[model samples]
Target: MARILSIVFNPSVDISCDAESVQHTMKVRTHNLKQYPGGGGTNVARVVAELGGHAELLYLSGGAVGSMFEKLLAAGSLAGHRFPIADETRISLAVREEQTRREYRFVPEGPVVTTAELQPALDFIADYGADYIVASGSLPRNAPADTYARIAAIASRTGARYILDTSRQALKSAVEKGGIFLLKPNVGELESIEGTKLDEEGATRAALAIVRRGAAEHVVVTFGREGALLAGSGGVLRVPARHVETVSAVGAGDSFVGAMTWSLAEGHSIEEAFRFGVAAGAAAAMTPGSELCRRADVFALYEAGSRTIN
Candidate 1:
């Protein structure tokens, strides 16, 4: 098994429920309330474990909410290492309006992490090197913008493939600093980095440019329903989106990153892994609320999609 470590600077307890309708100045009754451990890296780790792969999860935890977060996480299969912090962890909520079938999500910015609280994670990465190091999600307030870039450097020093999925300055800093093994960026994020609007052809060109410039060994740009495009040394490969009933969009991106990393670690080729990733992402969409892709759904989708891609 390939050793994988997933780092999350901001973690949360995700609560989701269904309400008949959301109206102002009214107490709306909710049903089927569900809670799960959530965050970019945490979700990725959960998805990896769901696919029968093991990934070590490292996350910041503190305060009363953090204690509850720990309990929720302990219910899952992932082996998590909680780094203590001073501030309370955040709680995110999603309420689905039954009338419109739309989801309303309320997300907090998360706790402000100090330098001392952040250093332990870097130190841990240096000591517990793995085959792949995945850092996903947003940088909490007070953390440096180049945090992921610093992680990429540490991964380089330890000879581990670094996979980053983020947005804004963190994304720009890492891309500019280079040394990333794989970068998963949505179309908007790629556009922000390149500082321009991109059509399909332009997106492909931009991805290829990043590869050629040594910014990232591989770049995958996700285009929601249209699908995703991969650019690397071999060239660009495109996979169309799988048609599925989207119950919730949560965790779809994390599923892609987790499944792709697992497939690559399992000795599959980059092309094969990319296909698996698309399948996992679609599978996650098929699920309800914050629940990720199911193992059966992933394999079935992958096998079905593989035929068309082949």
Candidate 2:
């Protein structure tokens, strides 16, 4: 198995519950509450483990809430190396209103992280190199915009394929610095980077431009229900989205990245890996609240879709 390492700058304890109706000035009764360790890279690692792949996790945590988060993670099959921070890890909530079939999410900006607290993670990445280094999620308040850029540099020096999934200044800075092996950006995020609304043709052109410039070797733009497009040196390949009843859309993107990475690490072709990613994403949507893609569902979907594509 190819060694994989996933890093999360801002992690969270994700709490989800369902309520009949959400109304102001009323005590809403909730049930089916679930809690999970969450963050972009954290979710990626979880999906990898779910698919019988091992990905070492590196993340920052602190305070009482951090302890609670650790317990939740320990309950899973992943073991991680934690870098202590001075601030408490944040808690995010998602409430599903059964009446409207809508999910409401409340997320905090997260605690400020000092350079001192962030350096250890950088150092760890430098010393503990792997086949692939996945840096996902947002930078905590007060972290440098060039943080992911610096990580890209480290991945280059360590001879690891760097995969990045982020948005805003972080994404811009990293792409500007180049050397990314794969860049996964949703349509909205791609639009944010391009600074304009892009139709499908415009989106393909933009992704190819990035690849031609050597900013990234492969660019995958996900369009949710419309499916995803991959642009690389070999040209663009489109994977249609798997239509399924969505229990929760949360974690679907992470599931895509995770399963794709695992497939790549297992020596599958880029096209095969892309198909696995789409399958995992659909499987994740079929699940409830913070839970990622299931292994059996992933393969079933992948095989079924493979036949359709064939």
lDDT of 1 by residue, 215-265 (tens): 999999999878899999999999899888888868889999999988988
lDDT of 1 at 304: 92
Report lDDT (Cα) of residue 310, candidate 1.
62
Worst window of 10 by summed lDDT in candidate 1:
72-81
In candidate 1, which residue ranges exceed 4 Å CA deviation?
A: none
Off by over 4 Å in 2: none
State residue 146's C-alpha deviation in candidate 2, in Å: 0.9
Which whole-number lDDT from 0 to 100 does residue 116 have in model 1? Answer: 95
The pairs that clash in candidate 2 are none
In angstroms, how far off is 296's CA in candidate 1? Answer: 0.4
Instruction: Give model 1's TM-score versus the native structure.
Output: 0.98
- Assess every candidate by TM-score: 0.98, 0.98
In terms of lDDT, model 1 sits at 0.92
